[model samples]
Target: DQEGRIVFSNPASHRIWDGVGIEELGQYRGWRAETGEPIAPDQWPAVRAVRHGETTLNQLVRIQGSDGSEKTLLNSALPIRRADGEILGAIVLNQDVTEREASDAALRQSQEDLQHSRQLDAVGQLAGGIAHDFNNLLTGVLSYCDLLLQELGPGDPLRSDIEQIRHAGKRAAMLTRQLLAFSRRQILQPKVLSLNSVVEGLEPMLRRLLGTGVSLAVELDPALAPVMADPGQLEQVMVNLVVNARDAMPQGGQVTISTANRELDIAQAGGIPAGAYAVLTVRDTGVGMPPSTRARVFEPFFTTKEPGKGTGLGLSSVYGIVEQSGGRITVESAPGEGATFTIYLRRHAGPEGAQAKKEQRKVLPLGTETILLVEDETAVRNSARRLLERHGYTVLEARHGMDALRLLEESGRNVDLVLTDVVMPEMDGRELVQRLRAERPEHKVIYMSGYTEQAITSGGVLPPRTAFLEKPFTVDQLMRLVREVLDE
Candidate 1:
């Protein structure tokens, strides 16, 4: 006892040191829990109490029994002195807190991840709002550019200038679309689909994009659950991640695309609600990201690449696409350890007919049907009308839904199709459609909007059968969609 040795142990202590030999009890092995360093002999609580006639207060420690079962414990030791003040050995008490500590750590990480997600959402909202307004302005700019370019004769200097203007507008439109995506304001046409099939479809294209320097491997979980998401957008997310990985390793590396089913509780949900999730993991053995870069990797226009090499919307758009599809995304990376991007999408148990891919559709040429165009923005309305009229359609203009209704009722069967903006003052497109269908239930409608993050949710941006036309559409896009909707 005077030699700082454990003479005996109680049943409670025996359970904790179960696999440890009685002879080995004389040398208790432990470490400082916080620092993860072995507890020095001088710093051993029981030894200090027994040899120096001291008392050791609660200390957090990591201990492993002979069986190698490690545990975190709150340990304390006190000198066992008799009534005459002669010290005996000492008594040590340790409270196991391994599970509790792990839970606390998980909670801390979840909170941090949630806070980061909110910050990114705030930035996304601002970007989306700006892009929404810009989309309207660009609609007018691009449409007028299209009209001017068409009027200009070939080999004319003005044609080239107009083409340049058109080119610049197209670029701006692309950037705005990315911003809308990040903001989750862009309209989505979600369908129940399998991630495995999606990965299989894109494998060939992804391989070509990665070049010979990068090896692509896909691991699909046979029991993967279906998720409701836009197949095209999911492809975009995969493409962005693959490109990001490829860029990180300019020389050579391995990229793995995998899918699995994940069940998460709120404590481990990675900023989303607890439930069954369809997980898609993209891992790359490439130059990894530091904490600083990892923090802002999903931020719009934030890039680590040299100037002209990147626009920084790649990951941001990916983040938005997943989030808008009711999913959570997380990234793990260290400077030299490479990076792993994990996306958790809500599992869908829709009908058995859930498609592995969207059906192929036949597109149409320019139209000749009479159409009603209802838009609140005068410039956008005029630009659209001019474009439609030039394509041989009789375009009727309306300032709002009320005006469109008045024009439509007066024109009767003369108006062949109704194309309206979703966000209009004093009777929106949905209400206008309701009024139109009240008289003629068979009438068709197409709703267009710059951003539908706040306004649209139901399928097809309306009920089951309605079509959507996104703003800042190209001349060809407008013509093609109008013809298709009319034919349907």
Candidate 2:
């Protein structure tokens, strides 16, 4: 008993120190759990207790058993002595708490994820609400600029001033577009596409963009499944991720973009439901973000860059685009360990097909046909009427769908195209089109909207074969879409 060797051990202790017999426990190895530093042989709890008459209680330590299995333990030790204070041996106790600690960590992560999701949703609602109104104002400002520039000939000295004003409006329009994206209100034309194909196409451009400082590595699964998403938006997502990774490594590093087909159960899916998914991951071998930075990484306008260096909308839009396409994005990083961002998109169930490419026609041919323009905002409607009339089109105006019906009936359905806002006070454009279709099945209608979240997005895409125009549409966009729809 006076010796320092472990003479006996219980059955439970043997299991906790798997593969290490009772005789070998005195030489058992462990490290301090908090710092991952080794616990020295001479400074071990039992050794310290027997040698220095010290006591150790409930110390958190991590141990790797003889079988190479790692576990967490709560350890305690006290020196054994006789009545004359003679130093004897030492007693040690350990309770394996590996599973309990892991469970607690998972619970904490779930709670934090839930809270973060709620905050994003609330902010998204606010962003969506204001973005619509901003689009309305931008349309008026930009359309007026288009009108002024049209009247000014090449010799006009005032042309440049109006051009500057037009340029500012366009910049403001881009900001609103990004805001709509972050709010999940921007329109998308999603279709079944191959994730692997997208990555392969970007490989060349990504390499050129990364330059000599950073190397690009692509790992694509041969059996990767198809996913339904807006190809352009998804490409933008990849570009943003690569750019982010590139920025993290200033001197030199490797940026890896990988894709795989993964099947996850409920436990593995985290917040998403159990299903088949297409996973895209971007990992960089560079300095990584801390937990505090990772928590707000997806937030709109949350950037770590110095002032005026970034807009901070890159990751936020990435978050929105993924969510709108019924996917989820997760990021993992620790300081100095590099960062990995993973996106999971649901597998497409329908027959896989590529998006059809449409040929572009830049001609903005003048229209001679009669048209009906409906908009609740007086400024937007008047601006549109003036723009059309200048191009030789006879324009009829209405504030709502009911008024449009009266005007159309009075004209004996002679209008070439009924252009109306999708969101209106009395009757929406869809309802008006329904009634008009019953009366005259050949009537042509074009729908326009600023508040698009509730109106335009039908399962994250537009209705089939629909001619639609987003708000703040530029002069060329308005003209081209009008001519294109009328011809169709």
Per-prediction TM-score: 0.87, 0.88
Q: Write the per-residue lDDT of candidate 1 for residues 244-330, one digit (tens) a residue.
A: 999999879999999999987653546767889899999999889999999889999999999999999989999988888778788
- Ten-residue region with minimum lDDT total, candidate 2: 18-27
Model 2: clashing residue pairs? none
* Reference-based lDDT, each prediction: 0.82, 0.83
Candidate RMSDs in order:
3.6, 3.1
With candidate 2 superimposed using the best TM-score fit, by how many Å does residue 384's alpha carbon deviate from the native? 1.8
